[model samples]
Target: MKKYNRIKLWEGLHSSYWFVPLLITGAAIALAFFMLTLDSTGKSGLMEKSGLKIYTGGADSALTLLSTIASSMITVAGTVFSVTLVALTLASQQFGPRVLRNFMQDIRFKFVLGTFIATFIYCLLVLRSVHTDAEQPFVPKISITVAILLAIASILVLIYFIHHASTSIHAWHIIREISDELESNIDYVFSENPGNSHPEHKRQLVEEITTGFEQQAYPILATGSGYIRAIDYDRLMNIAKSKDLLLHLKHRPGKFIVRGSKLVRVFPFERGNGKLTKEINYAFILGRERTAFQDVEFSIKQLVEIAIRAISPAVNDPFTAIRCIDQLSVALCHLTQREFPSPYWYDDNDQLRLIADQVTFAALVDDAFHQIRQYGRQEVAVTIRLLETIATIAEYTRNKNNYVALLRHANMIRRGSENLFEKLDREDVEAQYQVVLQRLAKI
Candidate 1:
């Protein structure tokens, strides 16, 4: 069979089960034709010698009325042939090969048995005309009983195969989810927040040579671009080593990560691999770009985690919190404007829409807006006025100031769209921006 194996390659062709009825029909036709030819020129009866008797008083003869050998054979054959064409064609055209492949793998052998038994039963019906004056025979034909048995067995086997195949596919999906998640985390950290760590701040490396990273760790979310290196995550390991921060590394590859998700906890070890302690601080929190996620459910969960981690530093160390929040806000806003214009600087709604149940990125963005507003809450009028001015120019700057809502008011505009910047007086906005720039310069 291996040398020119039909069985090995048969699956590559259309499903064998799809031809089940056709095969039985073909067999019935062959038996009918052979019996008719033996009986001769549609006249003579080989039936006389066989000693069959007709018991129906003026009952219609099956042979003369139905043309038992010709019509039954043809009907059986047509049914088989048409069914095979319909099933196989539907599988290929409507469902496509992937689903069809799974289906046929389960039922091929039983289908063959079903065809064989059905043909045998058809042959028994032909036996009726082989003998003459055929009444209902007192004893059933041996061929009829045997064929029925095979049909039953074949159907049972088909059922078993179907059950087995479905169970296998369900298990496979779980592992795929895990591997996909890890790749997502890498994309978010390296690409989405690259160049700058957040939306509101320019990324500045904090290099120093102390035990400053003693208990430092951060989460990597899978919302950004997935792992760029298709070969593996060797790129990240190399980056860690380059920054001289590759101390006691921890983490198994191919694990899913959420946003702000903490990875292997570690402190800075002996820094030597080209990493300046003060210049290259750990930028653990990361997010991928918009398009990287294929599974929105998986990616959204990761983003929410990153958001939670983002807020942790605020309570633990407010100064560091201020820096982290500033950078994240800026980075998020930059990421948004890169694609379509969004009213909120960070609207993960379109991309992570599927995982909305798990991670409400909208809520996180709204929360960050609230957290940052507290900074301007102090009675310092200068800082408060500066915040409002900046909010007017950079809408992202307004998120914490309740200024974005003012810009986002759908009711405020006559056009029925809430893009305030589009309708705002440009000179007034520019004037506000210049004032903030002066304040920023002074700071």
Candidate 2:
């Protein structure tokens, strides 16, 4: 049996709008049962002596009212769902499919769906409590009134959902949301003083990992094919410490792997127990698609997708592309300041227990601008923004190698513009390119 991390389970539930509502509905039904019981027992002083008029209606009237509300709620729920699907379809078409996940994960959409379903369930549960006895009828007055309130609340949520869905699909909102998410993900993954910011530090870490130990290692093959979503570093480190073994991860999160491919290489080549292999496999959480939780690059790619869509000839929306570039610059600026985790994981005694690949600032810089340059080279506004983004990122970092990376990308943007832009447009791009060169020269 394959064990999944809790993060994966929560992510799956979070992406869907149904889970929370279903849980709430179940709780509502249970609460309805308890509250109806209180109303049934006339022995309670509050129920017997309340001045508020309890439902004085007969069972048939109560049934008709509850049934009508229940039926209407369900009908509205269906309509809301239909509208949600339409919104998602339009967003995917207009923005790009990458952002569809953001729409699916919107809390407003989930709350609206959950609210209606919960109201319907609450009504049905309360309706069942209206007993039709010829001599002594029973009515859960409080529960019925609560149901009415819920129905009203559902109406409010419906209105809110309409407004949210309309605004969420706009190009600016989508770009801003992706950018905000990218910024937060960068903060989560990188620390205040990323040790690998400097070239010498990065080279030292690599040298230590490569030359730290000499042991015969055996490869652990992946049982499935998918993107590496998350890795259980604590567990892998514990396994290495307990067994006195060294583990070298072949790839990091966001990398795709095929079945039967080497996932990790375990040292000392001893086949003593099958448990080690199982534990090693369990540490890797593979999924059909990449997620933003542990993969910062995946978030970056989301912004990239929007930029690509904005610049496409079908859209010709360079302003939206420029907005995306501006946000990417924000994300890159934050990333440059933070410290990336070392690829080498050391044990308590300072011995290297794991060698996992880590993301570098240079690689991130490339990921941020390479694709946009390829697609947006013809658009002078986009190309100018691209050069400006690189230049802004260059100003924030102290690392010399990062300066080199920025200059290289700046040169690429200049060359790409010269080829694609008209002579006049090319001049404007060169002007921006010179600004980037001046910044790099100061560094």
Angstrom error of the Cα, residue 28, model 1: value is: 10
Worst 10 residues of 2 by lDDT: 191-200
Q: Per-residue alpha-carbon lDDT of model 1 for 1-443, expressed as tens digits?
A: 13212322443343445455456556656655564454444222323345543222222443343344334434544554454445546544432333333344434433444454455455455445444445642222222233344445545644654453334333122122322443454344335321211243311222232135435532222332222111112333334444433332222222244433333322333433223321222322222222222222233333222323323434332332333333334434442333211111111221100000111233324444343333322312222332343343354432333334323321122121222344344334345445544533332
Q: After superposition, which runs of candidate 1 have C-alpha atoms over 4 Å from their true positions? A: 1-77, 97-100, 103-117, 120-129, 133-443
Candidates in order have lDDT scores of: 0.35, 0.81
At residue 402, give the lDDT of candidate 1: 30
In the range 102-153, model 2's lDDT, one tens digit per residue, is 9877877878888888889889888877888988777677777677778788
| Total clashing pairs for each candidate | 34, 1
What are the candidates' C-alpha RMSDs? 21.6, 3.2
Query: In model 1, what lDDT does residue 199 have?
Result: 43
